[model samples]
Target: MANELDGRVAVVTGGASGIGRGIVERFAAEGAKVVIADVQDELGEALASQAGPDALFHHTDVGDQEQIGELVATAVERFGALDVMVNNAGISSPLRRGLFTEDLTEFDRVMRVNLLSVMAGTRDAGRYMAEHGGGSIINLSSIGGIQAGGGVPVYRASKAAILHFTKCAAIELAHYDIRVNCIAPGNIPTPILQSSATGEDRERLERFEARIRAQMRDDRPLKRDGTPEDVAEAALYLATERSRYVTGIVLPVEGGTIAGKVMARKAGSEIPANGAPS
Candidate 1:
């Protein structure tokens, strides 16, 4: 089989698990040397080993500029060159906590991890890619970025910033042939979602998850929730030559959820709350 990305070197932040892991796997399968950068030592190492010789694990805290720089350096040193950078490392605000009483520290943490880290990684990685001519930068945003999520004000703001930052980077780097794009995913059932749920938050989260599951299966037009693979495929397209002319665009991998609101009612099943069929 002809590998679309044969001989390429790709760096994926948060590559140890979730959507980032999927992107890393897809890239490696296409013959790219991958660097998995994450704070998760055990999982990162395990994933690297499973991905074969072309994969390297760099225990990195992406929010730290020094660590991000080192991550880029490691990729270039090991692979001879850098061709793609996926700024996929991120975190969400704790769930069941209303915005009013939310701690500022929690907000800062989310901002640093989800927003500032993308900025740092892209800046460092872009320097390398530009010096070598060009490459692709994929930033992870979310549906909540475009739409409002009631309780997570900080997360919403950070993601919204990510989308705009991607456009700005694209404009500035296009001259160097470096393409920057953002991927906005919706309702991906990842550990990140679960991590947002805590002991006190469990009941509310359970109900929320139930509502989401119902929407995914019978409420949405597609009748399904999106998987990590959906977002990975989008990243793959954006990273490869396939999107040579694509840049500065926020691509929604949200299964049409972003395009249209799917209420908990399909054509034949939307019964009125008043116990009457409309």
Candidate 2:
């Protein structure tokens, strides 16, 4: 495993924390020179330093297209190449009582950060990889995009868009040998949800999260929470030659939740459609 990614260069957006952090650490340990990108300068820098000389922190607001372009240039310039591009930085849409209580105020920010950033990162990385030997591009999506239900509609919409966009990018970038894929994680408890909500949304989000956790005892198939490392394992596969022939696909790291609960099969049973812990 340590030699699997030797000589590779990877960029993980939102690498400061959560699933992105797991990928960064995993890639670095596996011998890849990793670039950590995030607006959290403190966390990003600390993680980069901890990862040693082969890793560097690049303060980037992925929501900004110009910044994303600059990030690609910086990665190529610093690392000398961009072998793996992971557009994993994302923000959750505010949770609300229901659709009626939703004002859609976070629409712009959510789309820009969650959706547009992936699009730009792929294009920018694809452009470079297309010329200097194509590479792997992995996008972070959520099961919320896969299953339909309530709360965080914008977040789900943005993720769903990433799924379709990844496929389209894969088709076009395939000419250059760039393999594009996606990871859809669920029930992985990251601070992302709490980090996204504030004020009244906080209380509501807490209760909602508690309910999900309680239900996981009997509802989810595995009945265990997922971790960033779980999703990172999937990422590690896609980044290396192991998935060379794979492209334009979504890999779910969910604990069989995506497959649906099987113990108590009932008609009209509902699955949670909110954004994931990843």
Candidate 3:
């Protein structure tokens, strides 16, 4: 799979950093022409430079539907076609005192960026793919969406919407050979966890982040920590023909955190006295 995406064209939203950046680099290495869309001008341009000529940086605010449209148009106009669309731009809602006291002030912005953006990207990209013989669209959700909990409730809701929206879009777009899938990543350390916090909530967010880091120490089924590259690998699978028949599914790259909590035990606790059970 050295060049699994050879001759393909891709557009990755929020490709300046974190998980998005990883996908951009990976896709480029796999021989795909990529458009890195993000509002972070400097970082985006720098990344494009590192990714070589096949990668282009486009200033895009995914919260603005118009910008999203322009992103797709630019990709096709510049690259000749759009084969893979990665909707990875998003923001985390601030932590409130509680759901009862939650003002839901960030509701509109969070929903617009996280949920609506995905819909628009899928539509704009799918429209071209539909007529261009179909392609793959990967939407980035989160483990928070699949496993409910407190804190960042709005952010979680927005991500949860993407899961269903992706599946629905998959069903509707299948006739055109387009495959739509969602990737829910968790336990991957990123600066996104600290975004959108205000005042005292900022301190709380730090503590919450610390708790997450502590939990990831060894609690999950997989002992090692996950990385942006881990999620990028999943994106690669969906982008290639290996997943030609796969669509409307949620792939979790969270070290099996969503499956169930791992019970802690001593290193040799599981071994029986006989030491073997053939």
Candidate 4:
């Protein structure tokens, strides 16, 4: 049997590290010609090198429309066609220890990097993919989009917008055979989360961890932290012909996070708080 993505071409934004990097590697391993698009030149180039000849690195800041256009142009130039575009470029503001106000500038930056960047990449790459041939476009959303995020309001809002954008675009591009989808990831143990904590704030970070586990306890039916490969597997499904019938859907790569919510409520009822409840 042939590999799922054999001979296909894939473009992943922010492919230098974390979830995007994992997706790029998986796509490459499946035999897709991958493009690593990120602002981190050294790491991106290194990653591309390790991905083999089929992978190319382009220094891209998705917040810049011109750069995104160039990124698409580079992919087509190198690989001759674009088959899958994963808009995974994003960043979070510095995490707050507790309920703290965010800077107005940070809010703007979050919106630009998380939301508008996806819009730009999707618009350009979707058109390119449609024109070349029908392809898959995967937008990286977050579990926060569907739930409340107290620490990162802007990040939450931006991800929420991306989910809607994925839906709206899926409808518009269906005519062209370009399937658009979004993946909402659960609490994955990525550097993105670790970077938010400070060495001096160990207790604060521990509290944050407890809260995350609590949230996820009810949030996911599966009691565990997600991995980057988990999300990549979902991307593979969306990118390949395996899911040819699926389009414009938001797949929660959340390991029962979405599925286990109701069951968790029942579980909570059965195991009531020892000191406070009946």
**In terms of TM-score, how similar is model 3 to the real structure?**
0.94
lDDT (10s digit) by residue, model 2, range 1-278: 56789999999999999999999999998999999999999999999999999999999999999999999999999989999999999999987778999999999999999999999999999999999988999999998889786878999999999999999999999999999999998878888767545564657878866776676546568877889999999999999998999999999888887676667656655555674322
- Runs in model 2 deviating more than 4 A are 201-207, 265-278
lDDT of 2: 0.91
**Cα-lDDT of candidate 3:** 0.92
Which of candidates 3 and 4 reaches a greater TM-score? 3
lDDT of each: 0.87, 0.91, 0.92, 0.85
Best candidate per TM-score, number?
A: 3
Q: Candidate 2 versus the native: TM-score? A: 0.91
Model 3 Cα lDDT, one tens digit per residue, 145-213: 899988789999999999999999999999999999999999888888777456646668788778867
Candidate 4 lDDT trough over 10 residues, lowest sum: 260-269
1-278: candidate 1 lDDT, tens digit per residue: 34878999999999999999999989888889999999999999999999999999999998788899998999989989999999999887776557676766677788889998999988999999888989999999998899775866777889999999999999999999999999998878887766665564678777877775676555345656788888988998998899999999999877676666665546776677998888
Question: Which digits, one per residue and each the tens of the lDDT, describe model 4 over residues 69-184?
Answer: 99999999999999999999888766665555555457877788899889988899888877776899999999888777577666788999999999999999988899999999
Worst 10 residues of 1 by lDDT: 215-224
Pairs clashing within candidate 3? none
Q: Which model, 1 or 2, shows the larger TM-score?
A: 2
Best by lDDT: 3
| TM, every model | 0.90, 0.91, 0.94, 0.87
lDDT preference between candidates 3 and 4, better one? 3
